[model samples]
Target: MAPNRREKGNTVSDSDPHFSGGGVAADGFDRFGTLPDCLLVSILSLLPIEDAVRTSVLSTRWRRLWTLAPLRLLDDSALRSEKFPNKKLLAFRAFHDEEQWRTQEGWRVRAIDGVLSAHAGPIRSCRLSRVYFHIPLLDGWIQTLSQKGVQDLAILIPMEKRFYLVHPSLIACQSLQSLELCYCRILKPTQPRPNLVNLRVLNLKRSLVTDAAINDLLSCCPALQSLALVHCAGLRRIHLRSPTLCIMMLDDYSWEVEELFVVDAPNLEHLMLGKNTTRRTHVKVLNAPKLELLGFLDMSIKMLQLGSTTCFEKSMVTLSTVVHSLKKLAIRVDFNDDLQADIVFDLLRCFPCLETLDVLIADMDDDDEPDVEYWKQQVSLDCLDHHLKSVTLKGFLGQRTDSGFVNFLIAKARVLKVMTLISVHAWKEGWVETVQQGLCLQNKASIDATVVFMKEKHEINQFQPWSSLF
Candidate 1:
């Protein structure tokens, strides 16, 4: 081979003889090498950073393509290997092999740092999951990203470590449109807060953030549309006052949230509230005119105040204005003998225009069967008469109360097309057949109505059950 050489900065062009077939030939052609740089860079961007960088060795044309591509850095240990251990084994490994743990941690840090340092363009997104790094290194990387005008950033530390307080520069990034922080802490800014004018989505999971800090952050993001806070610590009372917020989810499995208040959110559309237990929390939804989807799961709230005059006490209540805009509603509650049917009826009455309803029955050991008499006392609602179309009931036990509630829906919901009942407990001999026969015999208001019965083994075994409704 006579000195195969090219000038510095000379990239392989489509017309190059070597690329066209003089020297390079794959499957009798060099189609890949002839592709445009932008298209190649897009292909590289989808691969993991490590894999993307390795492509640099393929050819001179590919050497610098990855650096120009939008950077997507993900440090997920679970994706590191196919045989990754379970949580218990991971905990054991973290405690037993200190040296190996440190070595792996250092390798991940260097890998991420090496890529961020070499890349010269704006990063599209960066996600670091279950990775621990030195505070200075993390701060420097965040500062670099801020300066580079990163659009999306996610920093998820390992659950075993203490909450890592994010750097100030990260919060001040004007280019950020979406941000997610898990197992971290959002510190109170010292001086004037930076207005994240473009931020639309914000998710904080298992974080340690005070109510004041969160409220202040929301105030700064005037254009925020979606916000999710899951199992956050030090958040007893959350007052959301965003005017532009459209979707919000609050999942405090620890049951630490004592009070939740939403005010002046005119554009609010979807709201999800979840708690692990049936804890008594105060929730108020006010001034949300465009609200459509509402989910209140795993809690028997003490009071749910909707607007000014409408409120739900221990039983339930209705807000005509609030429910008029609601199209979908989901709720999970423990079965109370005296209040189960009343609660369901009150909820249905509140949302006169609701089309979809999902009910997840929390398993309680007590034998407090659902109150079947309350079904007869149910006042006619527009939802049951005209609007309600779909009903999904999980954890159905086929008890008298459960069967009666189903029977009432079959007879009352004039527009209901589907009723899904998944049994949480194991079926006794001929129980499923009997329940199906009883539901079918009931005079359904809608002639097109169909009943679906599914046996959820995991629900009965006390394991988490998956729902196909969502």
Candidate 2:
């Protein structure tokens, strides 16, 4: 203290008696001091509220850093240990003051509460993955986030026996733009918020939301652009009537809708239907003037009713219903070999203007007869016309029914360009390849066609060179 160190203009680290080899270098102070306030804030913004709060211990400069950070509320224990190997579970455990099993549960509740209380302003994004909390608390948290103008929300709730309710406040989020709910339960519709005019995207995959609830939610969002209801159970019918919806996808293994009414979607361009119950369902095609793409899978369309109820009870979809001004057509059927040849012919006849056709022709185990030169003579491709330039056949069993269609396609397609035949089930001794080679010899000018035989089940890949329009 002889000539006080501060007065002597020497740095504090140099003057300290205990600084001989303590490793408290002058650079340590500069590290925090040199960081721009904006950079510090941005770094803090990415941290979970609890982690952000711990910044205060770093230095006096970080005492109020977390107040400006975005809240990342998560069930701390629900986070698999595999993700963060360095995660100090002991620190969280101490805050929880419980055993390993019980501390995790307490951590989640505390983490959520800490984030909500600390976030004074609107949250830009919230990512809650595999979180478990009381339903009421979730509702309240959603309400809190909505009021604060949370924009992006990704919620993956724990699959519990109890139902989960979507709070009405969630829809009220005026700044909300994107929402993703996976494997969740929408127990009931919450109150509607007035600020949800800007919402655009909603994805509910493998969710437990009823049709009525979905309808109610959809009706509320007037500006919605994309809606994907994938494997959402309890929907027997979906009346999708949205003027602003450009893309609508319904892919549920248990989706057995008797009727799907598309009323006012004029701008709707892409419609995808997948894995529906084989039972009868009257699908009404609405006035989508701009419609261009339609894809279906595992669907047995028993009736093809156009604008009128004039029923055409066919197991497969007629080509007319598919190729109407559409550039891309995908048909994936799960039918038995018992299908009538006439029905298959009718299905092929409808695609007049189809430039690209990808058909998955699968048959039951009972279909073993491979020779079908005689049967091929009976099928007609005159109606199919010359529009088909590119075609793909998946799960081709090299049976009479499949080969019959192949030979007809080779002979009748006037402007055929490229054809890909893939054999599914064990190849009946190079059945598809044999057909491909035979077709090439008969029609050298019948466009470039190739067949690929999958020797094993795992060898079957996705239809290559085809863009999934949906």
Candidate 3:
């Protein structure tokens, strides 16, 4: 049998407001009134657009509340579905008769037009996702938004059958602060945007903008603080004039790195240059005053003109001036063993004040590993910075060069605390023993630093492993 419970209109406790000792009134739910408009808007803004719009049907109080909150404009073409409605699609195709097709197309255009026009006010953020439109409609909407003053705009122009072009009026946004354009095809050359003075961050990732267009865009964004260009293929020589830009990330390796001139960037802190899939034919130099952090892979001989007298001479001249003031340095070597060692020495000598060094060796061929005693005596690690505290050698396979560098670090870096050796290939049987010999020779009395011999990236091996080496 079920225990006895309170029935409708019955209350047990008088102390609690919810429980009216003897009997409770049905009107108890009507105690709270509408919240402040600002608070309600904040709550609604956190909801998804579909759910936010659903608030309009909630009650009389919420009818127009959603419109008062922030609006996120979405394009219909950006939507993706797992399955298609075959029946509905067939029905739509059947309406290819002139009048019906015209009617359907007209309604579709009008719906989108209405959505965009409705939110033509002071918007906090606007996202135009994969939207395609003719010049007239695009211009009209952008001009309207510019007049209304939008703060953030994210335009992701996808490459598809439909023609998508950026309207010149969009760049004239007076109140725009943050703008992102991804995967956009440049249909025509655009006039630089001088009016977007308040723009803080500009990201053009995988954009079809030409080098000239990039320069023009950078010229307009004088107050931009952070700039990112990933696979913007046309960008060659970058000339940054923004005194406010402190952080930069350029990830296109195909473009010849022209001299980067950062003018009056007092606050510039970090600069990251990623690998170029295609070789950079020309030498690139960076000039910045306050740039303390730099992340760039050392260019290979093939990437450089190192083999030739002209390229080697050029590298020798530039490498000295590259990291003169840098406090931390990272060098990635991918070349012949003898050439790599020589370059490594030359590169290390550049960073006089380098405190931390991360060295990665890639594509070590089978023939590169020679007789241990013979190669060990030949390989040398000299002129390492005294201030170097941490050394990391990635893609380590216990080669003489690898052991030689470790041995050098163990001897030279007096203040060294940690040394890490990561093997991309499988762990050699005696790899640990060889590493231990280097560490033991460094006066076993000195602080025994942490040395890690790790074997990762084995699954990435394409060919059969060489069993003799292991």
Clashes of each: 0, 6, 1
Best by TM-score: 1
The sequence of per-residue lDDT tens digits that candidate 3 reaches over residues 85-197 is: 32553476575675654454445445446655765355666666533333345557667667767778776654552334566666677688988877664433446444668
Best by lDDT: 1
**By lDDT: ranked, best first:** 1, 2, 3
How high a TM-score does candidate 1 get? 0.84
For each candidate, give its TM-score against the true structure. 0.84, 0.74, 0.70
| Order of models, best TM-score first | 1, 2, 3
C-alpha RMSD for every candidate: 5.1, 6.5, 9.5
Query: Looking at candidate 1, what is the lDDT of residue 366?
Result: 67
- Which tens-of-lDDT digit does each residue in 78-150 have in candidate 1? 3342233336537756576777766666666776777788887678788777545555677898888888778
Q: Which ten residues in a row have the lowest lDDT in candidate 1?
A: 461-470
Candidates 2 and 3, the one with greater TM-score: 2
Q: TM-score: which is higher, 1 or 2?
A: 1
Task: List runs of model 3 lying over 4 Å from the truth.
Answer: 1-32, 72-115, 130-148, 161-164, 186-193, 256-266, 277-283, 301-315, 318-325, 365-386, 426-448, 455-470
lDDT, candidate 1, at 429: 70
